[model samples]
Target chain A: MKELERVGLPTVHVCTIVPISQTVGANRIVPSVAIPHPLGDPTKPLEEEKAIRRRLLLKALEALQADIEEQTIFGN
Target chain B: MTYRVVHYINQFFAGIGGEERADYPPELREGVVGPGQALQAALGEEAVVVATLVCGDDYFAEHAEEAVDKIIGLLESYRPDALVAGPAFNAGRYGMACGALCDAVSKKLCIPVVTAMYPENPAVEIYRKDLYIVETSDSARGMRDAIPKMARLILKQLNGEPLGRPEEEGYIERGIRVNIFRDRIGAERAVDMLIKKLKGEDFATEYPMPSFDRVPPAPAIQNIREAKIALVTSGGIVPKGNPDRIEASSATKYGEYSIAGLENLTPETHETVHGGYDPTYANDDPDRVLPLDVARELEKEGAFGSLHDKYYATVGNGTPVAYAKKFGEEIAKKLKEADVDGVILTST
Candidate 1:
């Protein structure tokens, strides 16, 4: 978060809900599926869930590569 | 000359009511309520709270256009010298509403729109440049203290006075860069600075180093089969029983914990103690914050040769800039020793 960015760690964050909580210190943010299960809801069948998880994982990777200022949220 | 000031507030602050009163649409009233009263008192005869507008959080968030239109219509008639809103403290919804309104008014009417909030409030980043935001306490208890500071800033804006630093002015640091002139001649100062540098005396840099804008893309892996990747984070993820004990805010240290043979983060094994959010979910399942699960999947897919056995972790909250840079350099040195080709970092 703030400490990491302050120390110049080149960090990015991913969360299922709005990470307003993290923005004070975080350099970047990527929206995820949910709080308890960020990759995908475990209630769904494993195969369907993995597909969603894979997609979000790719989005998180993209967030790390993207240059940003202040705080930015990826994946809308 | 008397300057007219328009005050903006949420339903509760406007005295129109709370959640129940939130449905109340935007309307203009004369004078002030809540912190606006303190603003009026502080600004004194120089400024008058000519109008007050109130709207519900749900109303503004859901029906932004309609609410803004109504509020703007009211403001247009008042023709205020400046607009002031909440030192919203830590209320996210209200802080956002204040930021939105201030941005709109400043852009549309070309009037100075000012508000305040706690540094922790998310609105500081969203609207710090668009408005004059003074830092306040996390609750209304800071009203008496926050209001006077905000009013003083508004007064300075009205008088066309140059603003001092955030610390001096009691505002949240906007991190805006501005060229400032010194009273002393530049040539003399330059010579003095050079002498200090040669003598190894600590001299403040005349020009602060520009922030690095373009990070070189991690060189494309020449061979994914042989390249090693590392997991790093500022998300405050750590092992159970809080072994490393990283400081929560303004962390001076970082920890690199061994994750050998761990395919995934489990609630029982890993936890997050970061103060920024409710760690209930992330603590119960560290992968939600660290994404070790995703890293394992990437390893299985042969995206890289191997995941480094140990991953670096730290608390990113309120960390100072100088220390962060040093930490990154140190971590980079470690990565080099381990032949780490790339890093996939996650944050909360």
Candidate 2:
């Protein structure tokens, strides 16, 4: 992804862990969900889980398209 | 019998244009093109160039999963006996692409694959262990020598020949620990190495430390209301009884506790298990350190969408960075699944 971004393509990485993402030098990241279950909250109701996942996916799309000068953390 | 081979190269080598065209997606052409011609000539008649796949550096980087999947599909159709990626020299992205593609070909296609790049190219760090990554000069000027070396290595793999050491084969060492018998004993080798070092002569260390990859932060949040925030701490705050019994120092595990029903954390309900600092202040009102009080106020005011029902806790003090990394990964995956948008991380 670094190679792709270096060549002027937009990229976004979504992670539940911030430090690991930062350590890896990911310049565009959106923090969402958790590690074991990144897209859904198993404890939540089905509709709620779907809504939660949808919000994160939307955020990720925005993050991928945004321009960044340095490593920045994105959150809701 | 002629062996079918697929040649992989970057946009620059394909003459699709330079970095300006680096965003170009992967495309396949029947038979040789651009540098493929030179590569084909070097292969002789025993090998026949079957196809060439060209992708822009930026394109592959941004769409790695898709790019590799697409490339894999293209190659499966050709059913090539061997895969040859670029002698990428010192071009960072090109080197990465070649190394990554070759790795995929070797793993997924289960075919013999070969590539060449400068030893310094960052790709060598990740992909060298897969197979033959011949050493090349830093630019296209060394293309002459790089071609045949890669060709020879792949041909050897095809012939099922026993391989020699990297030094003899003109490839970089993968730094794997192989227990080959040596002429000198451990004590003697250590003494010999010490003398060489004292004399300022070159002597490679038996074990080289691995370097970590550094990454920049992601873009900042643009909208607060649309965000779903969460709280996380390395300050060792947990339920008063500490159900998980996480250690005070060098903690081996982390805890995820629900903050779903709380307006504020009470002294009776929460306390610190961290061994590095005084617990008096944090124990007085757990909210001071964990900040559930402040977060609740914001949640009521609609400062952000909503707080994640759970927050993670662990002790940062005295924990190994490696352990910390593992915890971070696991926690992040959980938070990601929960659809958290941002986090408020506190450290003592």
Candidate 3:
């Protein structure tokens, strides 16, 4: 994500560990739900997981489009 | 038998004129001078200051190589057991001179070298790994405390005693990792640390995470609705047969798979090879990690311009930061060539 951002490409990191993402210096970050299934929670039903993934991806898109001078975590 | 020691200091510390005398050439004098008196007293009977080398900060800075060579030549005749440089505090030039002189003496003279400076001194970052630098206060006020630590550390070197950890020894961390046998396995240790953390007790991490360079954010996509987006992942998602053979841990290479005309990642088409986490959920539906299905939904909904046909993937598990950075740069180059306007990078 930092590399992409370096080359003038807007990037958002969807990560389970926000601190790790911050330390790695990602410009934009969206917190994922879990390590095993970052986009979809395993315990949730298939439809629910897809809905959660959609919500998270939407948040990621929001991050990519937002202007930020420093590292910013969207949706905590 | 007393161990012979050599001390190095800047002109100001040698009681020479401050700033105006900063151009004084390197000079060697017998016995302790200035702060060396305190350092010698700290050494007690175990060590004796046999010589002092004083150089102007400007002269050393301007002619570092020559100054170090001259200083080394002057000290070689004394054949001191160890060399000690200044407790330079926050003075940048003096701190650098001390650090450089110590480093040169340790290398060329092949003897133990010790220096002292404030932790925040720029020289600390440059020389901490190569030299033992006792932490000092930001100014000369730290002299009283710094000399003893510097003396003790040098004495440890002279006696060939094993050094303690940086915190225990009052020195800056060298950023070196040493392998040691522990009574408990890593899992048990982690659990113990977690419990301590939960109880709000202080517990040092076995491995401190390395910090990375921060890049200023690029401008936001002005028209994300008309942007060309790409997906990149460190979740180790790949084709059914693992054609690239990327390592499950410490991935050396990244794969760019064609997602062209694909609606979503199915178990028949994709699986995750990442070893850091349980792969069950991702194996069941690779989209759980990559989110191609939702991305397609958004694309069809005209939420963005379009998704790039190729998505990059690599395993983040235990990957060395250097390789990860290289892969990121290469992948970014490809994405740029493909005119990708934005990226959504997922990591496990």
DockQ (Cα-based) for each candidate: 0.07, 0.07, 0.79
Candidate with best DockQ: 3
Q: Where is model 3 more than 4 Å wrong at Cα?
A: A1-10, A22-28, A41-52, A67-76, B15-27, B55-71, B162-165, B175-220, B237-273, B279-286, B292-297, B306-314, B318-341
Candidate 3 docking quality: incorrect, acceptable, medium or high: medium
lDDT for every model? 0.74, 0.77, 0.92
Question: How many residue pairs collide in each prediction?
Answer: 10, 34, 0
- Candidate 1 error regions (>4 Å): A1-76, B179-348
Per TM-score, the best of the predicted structures is 3
Worst 10 residues of 1 chain B by lDDT: B212-221
Tell me each candidate's i-RMS in Å: 6.0, 12.1, 0.7
lDDT of 2 by residue, B247-303 (tens): 999999999999988987877899989887767766765754566765676667766
Query: What clash pairs does model 1 have?
Result: A1-A25, A1-B316, A2-A25, A2-B316, A3-B316, A3-B319, A6-B321, A7-B324, A7-B325, B267-B284
Regarding TM-score, does 1 or 2 come out ahead?
A: 2
Ranking by lDDT: 3, 2, 1
Write the candidate numbers in order of decreasing DockQ: 3, 1, 2
Error of 2 at B242 (Å): 10
* Candidate 3, position B90, lDDT: 96
Please give, for residues A16-76, the per-residue lDDT of candidate 3 as tens digits: 9998898889989999989988999888888999899999988988998898888888984
Q: Interface Cα RMSD for candidate 1?
A: 6.0
